[model samples]
Target: MNTNTIEREIAIEAPVERVWSLITQAEHLGTWFGDAGANIDLRPGGALEVRWDGHTLIGTVDAVEPTSRFTFRWHQLDTPAGADLTEQNSTLVEFTLTSEGDTTHVRLVESGFGSLALPAEQQVAMHADHSGGWPVELGHLKDHAAVVAA
Candidate 1:
């Protein structure tokens, strides 16, 4: 497996339309995304910051595919203790949502960190860390969407 890639997939109990709307809308994002350093401009070329606890995750939106997909350039602005990560740009995030009957399939891919601002070792480590981390984040999305749909 390529450590430089961050991929996560989850199935939500909401319809494709509902899931799409929740994920794409800035207001809905702020509601369920729990402010995890998350700041959504909701437009192309806008900024995104995902914060949890006290740390911050920063990124820029690269593209938005209406109700289908979204792409962004992602970086870790601060470490666990709010320490700045010297190696930035080791990440990029893309989200794809598909509707299948009453279920929505969400796929998240974050890559491009292999050649970012981080040292080679740290970059690889970050990639590995994100590999599992993304799924957990998606789980949050899944639960949030489920509740809203109900």
Candidate 2:
């Protein structure tokens, strides 16, 4: 019913400070996020590129709040680089981290699928693709954090 968004929450067995660095730092993000790699500016209005299966998804950072939150807007699957990102062509991704004693509670939400100007089939497919992928990626983050904490 909520094809417009995908949400995943994960608990990383690490402090908020460490998890914040893992998420915001480009080197860590590249390994856990995309196969080819990623380059993130990590500031508001900065550029973001995460390569997945040979496709480089372009995005712009919208917010950064140290260990608390990070947000961005990125174009969908098959979108070409250098293409302008309009509201109908991109989705907003928000990462919210809540400190829980020595652990970090991470909640990720990606929305805007219903507004995409893509064909109905493509929209549904992309929504489905991300629906399945976010949990796995969050799992990766959790595992990676565990390693780093170890």
Candidate 3:
């Protein structure tokens, strides 16, 4: 079985531009994502940080395609907040967007669980945690969009 990736899709009532802003902008990310705060540089090679419950997750932008796609490499769940992200210690997250009339489609993908250097049990647990977490985060994003776009 392929347990290396988690994928989620959500349709938002906001335009593509607004959805893109909500995901890429630090202000919106913190609200829909980390409870403490989030900050992003929003360009390839830029830094992304999300803080929640005293734990920080650091990421580096891997690609930026404006309102269409944003990709980043994030530290694994068990890794220390500020540790350097390596292939064995991080996973790839990609966000893709498409505009549909008055709404926007957001597709999220996080991969690399099978290749992580962590123990097999740890890898399985991380995959399960993320599989469940992404949906909630996307829901927050959709709700946040309604509030922001109103």
Candidate 4:
């Protein structure tokens, strides 16, 4: 496939700490990320679970650098419930925050699609789905951040 990683960035008109809370905390994350709800243990190696639509996605926290960087690894494709999520079946999702005066610049990258243990066409389709999803997701995040800041 021609794609393996999806990177998107947005400048939120909010302080770094405010942006960080929205991204790392479970409550705010559900509003912008999972629609249904989220339960994230915000620390390195902690468990991250997000429920969207009718499915629950499980992930492991890869890094949490408070107000700066947060990352996790999770299966990007639909697998049967109870499927073991490991590096062999998952992609890494990273969120980075940088302060620009009063605004926070948020960058998100989801990579490792080429390593998934799935059919080639399925891998390509998964990558394309996320590529289209990030802009809409980030736009929601930006709007949510604005409302929270107001």
Most TM-score-accurate candidate: 3
Q: List runs of model 4 lying over 4 Å from the truth.
A: 77-84
lDDT of 4 by residue, 73-100 (tens): 9876567776767756899999999999
| Best by the lDDT measure | 3
Give each model's clash number.
7, 0, 0, 0
Over 4 Å off, model 1: 31-37, 77-90
RMSD of 2: 1.6
Say what the RMSD of model 3 is. 1.7
Could you tell which candidate, 2 or 3, scores higher by TM-score?
A: 3
- The 0-to-1 C-alpha lDDT of every candidate, in the order given, reads 0.70, 0.87, 0.90, 0.88
| 21-55 per-residue lDDT for model 2 (tens digits) | 88888778887887778899988989998877877
Q: In candidate 2, how many Å is residue 49 off?
A: 1.0
Model 1 poorest 10 in a row by lDDT: 81-90
Residue 24, model 3: Cα distance from true site in angstroms:
0.3
Candidate 1 has a TM-score of 0.80
TM-score of each: 0.80, 0.92, 0.93, 0.91
Q: Give the per-residue lDDT of model 3 (tens digit) for 1-150.
A: 557999999999998999999999988888889888899998888999998888887899999999999999998756765677788989999999999987999999999998899888888898999999999999999989988944
Model 2 bad stretches (over 4 Å):
77-80
The Cα error of candidate 4 at residue 26, in Å, is 0.5
